[model samples]
Target: MTFPQNEVRFEQLSTASPSVIYSIEEYPGRPARFDYLSPAFEEIYEIPVAKAMENAAIAFDTFHPDDLSGYQQAVIRSAKTMQPLQHEWRIITPSGKIKWVQANSRPERRQEGVLVWHGVMLDITDRKQTEAALRESEATKKQILKAIPDLIFWMSADGICLDSMPSNDAFQLFPDSGRVGKNLYTVLPPDLAEMRRQAVEKALQTGDVQVYEQRIMLHGGFYYEEVRVVGVGDDRVLVIVRNITSRKQAEIALQESEERFRSAFQDAPIGMALIGLDDRWLKVNPVLCNMFEYSEAELLTTRMFTMVHPEDRSILQQYIEQYLGQSQTKDKKATQVELRYQCKGGQIIWVRLNLSVVRDAQRHPSYYVAQIQDITQEHAVNRMKDEFISIVSHELRTPLTAIQGFLGLLNTGIYTNNPEKTQRMLKLAMDNGDRLVRLVNDILDLERLSSGKVQLAMTTCNASELMQQAVDSIHSIADQAAVTLAVVPTKAQVWAASDSIIQTLTNLLSNAIKFSPPQTTVTLSVQTQTDSVLFQVRDRGRGIPADKLESIFGRFQQVDVSDSRQKGGTGLGLAICQSIVQQHGGNIWVESTLGEGSTFYFTLPTPDP
Candidate 1:
């Protein structure tokens, strides 16, 4: 067929559009006919156009049976209203392929009981499938959000709440406002609103996820939240809020407790140090630094064992070696030990040290905490008291034993027949009696001085006269021991209690005479100075051992126990002398060479004239 050029172009456009144009007549007993059918008929329904044009009833056969009724009803309604007919329906092609189609046209009533409709139809199969998939995805996302129990919100760039999903009542900060068409500033607090606005802007700008935390108070309890914002298209964001109130509360409580413990460790009155499993000091307090005479930095740099006294290191070393062998429990604590520690100045002081292990989160031993207290003076006093008890028991038994024996012999009439024999026995008994009296007197004198029951009578006296009187008092005892007393003449005058000075000197002379070898000279020398007088009593006796030099001044302590028993020397004389010298504001000490001799020196302060 021949056609004009414009008509040919229009025909090409229809063929390329892949649509069919149709006309319908609703006249009585008249059948509908397709006035035009594009080439798409064969491509879509698997039928040629000429066949569809011959009879419209043939194309109706391809309409899905389930959709045919709805399609017919929509067309009839549109025809009655004389409105544009728009409808969608499913069709099964002759090749058994299901396809979706849309019809768009206007219906016109030509006469009574007669209607003419013209429309174009196109395949919408891909669009319908895409829409169904989108619906399904949206449903899945909703289900997931519900399951997580999170507060999800969609907000615009201007901080307007577009949509939201509600959570539990306890966590719902804005109950009524989590809806569409609400501004964030109107619903939330001023601070939070501004923060969320800034977060929204940042998320939109960077196209990256933004996270933050905020605290809110509700119902007199603090609440914590975590907010995450992610940008969607068109300057909108999706914000997810999670309530972390419980977790935050736990963290705060833990931090506060840790801080308190840290403060206590730094400021405790007793010495404290934190040592690690490797026996290194991690930290030390001021008291510990003062006690050991080390600076904080020095202690931290030094090892714990280096500062322990050599004699007291064994037990501490044993613990360090067996640390790993102890119980693997975080709650287990180590026992305490009393030991000596060396100061920076090389002096040793007694301390009670307690150790406890600190653990990490994995229950592994991380470090150790050591608490120490100085007990040097207390321990010395306790030792002295124990020695006093032992000596007092022995001294009392000796006197009681002699008195019992003499009384028993007298009652038995053992010396009854001979008067001279009785008199000799009586004399021997009297000698022991006198010795007992002397021992008791020494005990009382030591007790009085130690307990501060005796006051010193301060007076000025000549040091030479004091030495002379002491020598004279011990003259007979020196002769009995075959020892000679040699006094170094000193013209020094001193302020002191004459009686107390005389007593101290006499005690020193008696000890020298008792321990002296035969024909040895016991020399008494007085070194006078401006502030004090130093007196020395030197004896050529079996000398004291090095270790007992300090302890000999303690009650009942002797370098050799045999010395206390053999020389008829009660251990109380030296203790009494020490007390007397100390009460007079003086110092006393002893120096000895192993086999040469011993010297006792004491200093008495001289009052200013």
Candidate 2:
């Protein structure tokens, strides 16, 4: 076909355009034909323009099968109404590739009853793919927000709520009507609003996330929340709030329990300690520090085994090993042992140790807890009890054997023929019986005083008179021993039981006289003091050994074991004296030199003025 000069120029311009520029004509009872087609049409559909112009059906065949019916309907409507057509539809290329295209055109009627349309068609495949990807991304974001339980908000920089995605109505702070345009100051408490304002300002300024915690009351209950804010753009922020009430309550409960345990550990009466796995002292209570005579700082820096007595450390170590080797089950019992501990001052003391283990989640040993009770006094008492039983048994058997043998012989008439022999034998047996009686009496008296069963009748007495009476009572014994008794009298008054004081003085005098040499003097004197009267009995006799001074006051204890048998002493006189003096709130002690003498001293509280 030949075109006019202007038409040729228009066709040349259309050849270089990206979009296909075309014109088509339609006649009644006739098919449509392209009056003009740009070179882009051939490039877009991979078909020759000459072929498409010869049969417009060549172009119509490129319409995707699914879009053909809709495309035809849109064209028919636009033709009847002579309206502009603006539509997008899918088309397939001659190469079997599917693509999207947009058509924008206007229809006009010509005088010969022919309809004509002029427009541009664009291949919008890339643009359609981009739009599809955007839609998919938006759908994915909605699904993710739906799955989370946190409350999310897009807020403006001025603390206005622009939009919100609440996981549920329970977490929504405001009604639907109150949201969107509401300010935080109206929706939240004043203090909470201020806190959020500060966080918002900080997030916008630094472009960093601001995180904080808030406790809110909602629906007549308390809720703890963790809020995080981050700048989404220059004028807006994304806020996320998570409810953490359960976790926070658990933490608070754990902290309170730890505080209670600390108080109990510190206030316990028995010694207690927490030891680390390395055998070092992690914590020590006040009682433990006092028991070991070490400060808390000293104990913490030292290993636990260092304070244990050398002979007992191995035993403690073995016990710990055995305990750790066993599985820690819920029904397992704590391990206990009695061992000795060496004090900081080098004194050894017995302790009953109760040990328990603490474990980690994996049931591995983490640390140890120890409870220690001082048992030193208990051990000493037990030892004394055993010794007392043995001594009493031997003492009673001796005199009973002699009395029984002599009586048996007399009853058998073995001495009936000798009157003088019988009399002597009878005297010996009677003497043994008297000794047995004296032993029994002394035991009963000592027991009564030791057990607090004997309550002394206290009275204000003259110290000089008590001394005189004690000396006089023991004067016959001193005479038999040929030991002189002298008294340095004092006019001091003592608040004491008269009979007990006299007996105490008598026992001291008698002991002195027995150990004194012939012609040696035994002096009894009293010295008055501010709050007490000091009584002294001095003798020139074989002195007590220094080591035996303290033990001599115990029942059945004596410096010379044979003294009880040879001197006719019951070995309980000094013990009785000690008990009596103690009951009167007095103290008794002895000072002795090896060969010179021994002086026994006792102090009794003076009578109240």
State the displacement of the C-alpha of residue 231, model 1, in Å, after optimal TM-score superposition: 6.5
When summed lDDT is taken over every stretch of 10 residues in candidate 1, the lowest stretch is: 169-178
**Which clashing pairs does model 2 show?**
none
Q: For model 1, what is the error of residue 501's alpha carbon versus the real structure, in angstroms, after optimal superposition?
A: 23
lDDT per residue for candidate 1 within 365-386, as digits (tens), equals 8998899998889899888678
Please give, for residues 275-391, the per-residue lDDT of candidate 2 as tens digits: 998889999899999998999998899897888888899999898878777645552588798899888898999999988998888888888888999999998998878888888
Residue pairs in steric clash, candidate 1?
A: none
The prediction achieving the highest lDDT against the true structure is 2
Looking at candidate 1, what is the lDDT of residue 134? 94
